[model samples]
Target: MAEEMKRMIALGFEGSANKIGVGVVTLDGTILSNPRHTYITPPGQGFLPRETAQHHLQHVLPLVKEALKTARVTPDDLDCLCYTKGPGMGAPLQVAAIVVRVLSQLWKKPIVAVNHCVAHIEMGRIVTGAIDPVVLYVSGGNTQVIAYSEGKYRIFGETIDIAVGNCLDRFARVLTLSNDPSPGYNIEQVAKKGEKFIDLPYVVKGMDVSFSGILSFIEATAEEKLKNNECTPADLCYSLQETLFAMLVEITERAMAHCDKRDVLIVGGVGCNEQLQEMMRIMCSERGGNLYATDDRYCIDNGAMIAYTGLLAFAHGTTTPLEESIFTQRFRTDEVHAIWREKEATEKKAN
Candidate 1:
C-alpha cells in the first residue's frame, strides 16, 4: 500500500460549483484538513457561472493556505496535488484547474485530475467502509445511481433533465427563501412543519428520474398559493420533498435490486437531507441491508473527497500531464475506469 511505503500526502482543490473547497489527505484515507467557502446569492437569485468562478478565484488560495496550515503540512510535504476535473460548471472548474496548474509548477509535484462524481463515490466508500455498495449520487447538477462492474463505475440510472437539488433550489427561489446556509436545508426545515401532502408529479422512467416536471409544477403551485393562499409554503415544501425523494429512492432501489447489492451508499449535496436518509434507511431495513452516508462536510462537494480519490488514482499510476490538464462540463460517471478497484472488478466477474 502507498501508506506503507511512505506517508502519502495529497493537496486537493475543489471548486466545481458555488463552493470553493480545499483539503489535505493521506493515502490511508485520513483527512488532515478540509476547509470550504461557499458563495451564497441573495434570495430568489441563482448563482451565475462567472460570479461563481470569481468567488472561487477570490478564495481558492486562502482556503488552500488554511488547509495546509490546519493539516500542519507545507507545500513540499505534499506527494501530489489534485483538483476536480469535470462534471461541474465550466467556469468554476477552470478556477480549480488553474490553481492546480499554478501549484504543480510552484511545488514541483505531480497532479491528479479527479472526476467530481467519482470523488464523491470514493469518499462515501472510504468514510463508510462500504465495500461494493450501490451509490446514489445526487447534487445540484447531477443525480446518478452508480455501481462497480467490469472495472468501471457503471451508471444504472440518472436524471433525465434537472437534478433533484436543482429542483429544490429553483423551488426555494420561487418561495424567496434564504440561501445563507443552503436552499435545500431551509426547505427541509419548512417541510417539517407541513401536514398536508399536495399532489405533485413524480417522473420515473424505468431506472432514471426527471425533475423538470416536478419543479415546474411546484413553482406554479407556489405562485397559486401566493395568489389564493390555498396552501402553506410548508405544505408545498413537504410535498415537493416527498415526491422528489420518493422518485430518487425508487430508482436507487431498482438499481440495488438489479445489482443484487445489499448496501446502499448515498453521496453528494442532496444526500445530506435527513428525510432522504431516513427514507433510505427504511428501504434498506425492509431489504435487510444497510445504508451508508456522510454528513454535509463530506457529502457536499469538498476537497477531501477529491484528495482521497486522487490518492487512489496516484497509487494506481494515474497522473494528468500538464499539457493535458483540462476540465469538462459533461463527463459521465461511467466514463471513468476504476483502476484501483481491479480486485473488486475481478471478484465480481468471477462470481
Candidate 2:
C-alpha cells in the first residue's frame, strides 16, 4: 500500500483566494515539497476581483515550477493534478482549473478539482486523526460547522454574512494593523496586550452564526471611542478577540450538542488564532469532547490540502471528465463524497 501510494505524486494548486500556493504531496499526507509563497494585492488597492485573478494567472506557473524544482520532481514523475474547485473567486479558480487541465494533458495524468473548504477540513482530519469530529472551518471566505452525513458532508451551521476571518481582516485594516503579515496572526499579537474587555453583539441562530452585526458594532464602538482616546488599539484588539472567539465557541458548542459529537476539529486560516483555539478547547472540554487542530503547515492556505484531497478522490475513482471540468464559485461542502477508508479498500481491491 505504501509503495503504491509512493508511486502517486499529487501536485496541488491553490488559487482559490488571495494566496496562490502550489505543493507536491504523496498519498500518506507526506508533503514531499511545498515551496511556500503568496501573492498580495498592493496596499490600498481595494478588492479587484478580476485583477486578483490576473495576478494568479501570472504567478501560477512560476510558483508550480519553483515547487516542483524544490521537490526535485519532474513533470512526468507526477501522477495527478489537483486544484481548488470553488468557494472562491471565479476568475482565480478558472486560472487554476485551466492550468490543471493543461497539466493533465501534458503529463497524461488524472485531474481532480476539489472543494477548498472540504480540503481544509480533510487536512485537519489527516493531521489530527480526528475520526468523527465536528468541523469548525473559519477562514476569510467561510465559517461553518460541518459533519459527514449520508453520501455527502453537510453544513451543520455557518455564517449568514462575511466570514469570521474576513471580519477580523476588515477590522485590522481599519485599525492599520500589519498588512504584510496575515491578519489573524497580527490580531493574535495585538490581542495579548489588550487589558480591558469590550462588549460586542453575540448573534446566534439555532446552530447557525453571524458576524456582520458584531463586526459593525465593534467598528462603530472603536470609532466612537477613538474620538475620546478612550481605549488603546491593543485593548480593542483583545476585546474583539474575546468577543468573537466566544461567539465561535458558543456556536461550536451548540452544534456539538445537536450532533452529540465527542470530537471537535478546527481548520482554515482562522484556526491559527490562539484565542479561538483556547476558547474552543475550554468549550469542548466542558462538553466532555476532545479538540484537535492542524499545525501551521496545514492550517493556512496551501496546495497540500488540495493535493491530499485530490489523491483521495482519485484513489476512490470519483474522477471528472474533461467535458465536465469547470470550477464553481460556491461549491457546497455537501457536494463531495467522503471516501476515507473506502478509498483504501477500493485501492486494495484494484491491486
Candidate 3:
C-alpha cells in the first residue's frame, strides 16, 4: 500500500450528467467540502445533453468557488485537480474536463482523471467502511454487480438494457411527475400510498437483469389504465418499485453467493431508494450478512467521490498529462486497474 501522506488535498469537478458537483477532499478520507447543483427539467421531459452541458458551464465555476470557500482551501493549497473522465455523457464530461484543464493551468497542479463508476465504489467503501463487499451499483445510466479481484473491480453482473433509475425516471415522465427533487423521489412518495401490487414482467437472465421489457410493460399498462381509469398512479408506482427492487435484490444476492462475500455495498443514485435498501437489508439478514449503503449525499454521483478516488491515485504516483486528460463516454468499470487496492488484495489472497 502507498503509505499515508501528510495532508494531501485535491479539488474535484463532476459534471457527467444533469448534476454538477464540486468537492475538496484530503488523502486521509475526510471530505472537506462537497457542493452540487442539479439541472432539473420540466415534467414529462428528460434533460437534454446540450442543455445539461450548458447548465454545467454556467454553474461549475461558482460551485468550485463555493467548495473552496467551504473547504477553506485556495487553489494553491490543492495538491492536485481531479475530474470525472468518463463513462458518462460526452458533452457534460467535456464541460468538466474543460474546467479541470483551466484549473490545472491556473494552479500549476497535476491532473488526476477518475473513472466515474470506480469513484462511486471507492466512495461507498470509504464512507461505509466496507471491505471486499459485493457492490450493487444502480444509477440513472448504469447498473452492475461488482467485486474486486485480480487488479480490477470486476463486473459480476450488469443490466442488459436500461438501468433501474432510467426505468423509474421514464415512468415518472409518463405520470407527468415533477423532476425537481427527483423523479424517483416523487415515485417513492406516491408509492407509499399504493395498496395494489399490479403484476409486471420480471426478467432476470443468469447473473444479468433487463429492465427495458419491464419498463415497456409497465408503461403500456399505465397507458391502458389511464384510458380506462382503471388504476391510480400510486398503484403503478407501488407495483413498479416492488417488482424492480425485487429483481435488484435477487441479483445482488446471487452475486454475494457467487463471490462468497457476506458484506454487500449498494452504490449509485437508485441505491438511495429506501424500498431497495429495505429489501437488501432483509436479504442480508436472512443470509447472516451485512449491507452498507450511503444516503442520497454520497450514494449519488458527486465531486467528493471523484476527488477522493483521485487522491488515492495521486498517492500511488498516478498522474494524467494534459494531452491524455481527455474524457470518455464508455469507460468501463473493469477497465480501471485498482492500484490503490493492490496491497489490500494481495494481503487478502495471502491470508
lDDT for each candidate structure:
0.92, 0.82, 0.93
Every model's TM-score? 0.97, 0.93, 0.97
Q: After superposition, how far is residue 47 of candidate 2 from its true place, in Å?
A: 3.7
Error in Å for residue 186 of model 3: 0.9
By descending TM-score, how would the candidates be arranged? 3, 1, 2
TM-score of 1: 0.97
- The lDDT, on a scale of 0 to 1, for candidate 2 is 0.82
Superposed on all Cα atoms, the candidates' RMSDs to the truth, in angstroms, are 1.7, 2.7, 1.6
Write one digit per residue (lDDT tens) for candidate 2, span 1-351. 769866677899998877788988887778877755555544423355788788888888888989899888998888788888898988878888999888888788888879898899878888898877899999989999887765567898899999998988888877877656576678789889889787778888887778889888888988999789888788888988887788778778877888889779999999988778888898888878889997677898898899988988887676778767798888888777777655544666799
Question: After TM-score superposition, what is the CA distance of residue 223 in candidate 1 from its true location, in Å?
Answer: 1.3
Q: Per-prediction count of colliding residue pairs? A: 0, 0, 0
lDDT of 3 by residue, 96-200 (tens): 999899879978999999999999999999999998899999999999999999889999899998888999999999999999889998999999999888999
Residues 1-351, model 1: lDDT tens digits? 534634888999998899999999998889999999999999988999999999999999889889999999999999899999998899999999998999899889999999999999999998999998999999999999999987789999999898999999999999899997999999999999999999988799999999998887788878887589788999999999999999988998999899999889999999999999999999998999999999998999899999989988997789999988899998888898889899556767899
Error of 1 at 135 (Å): 0.7
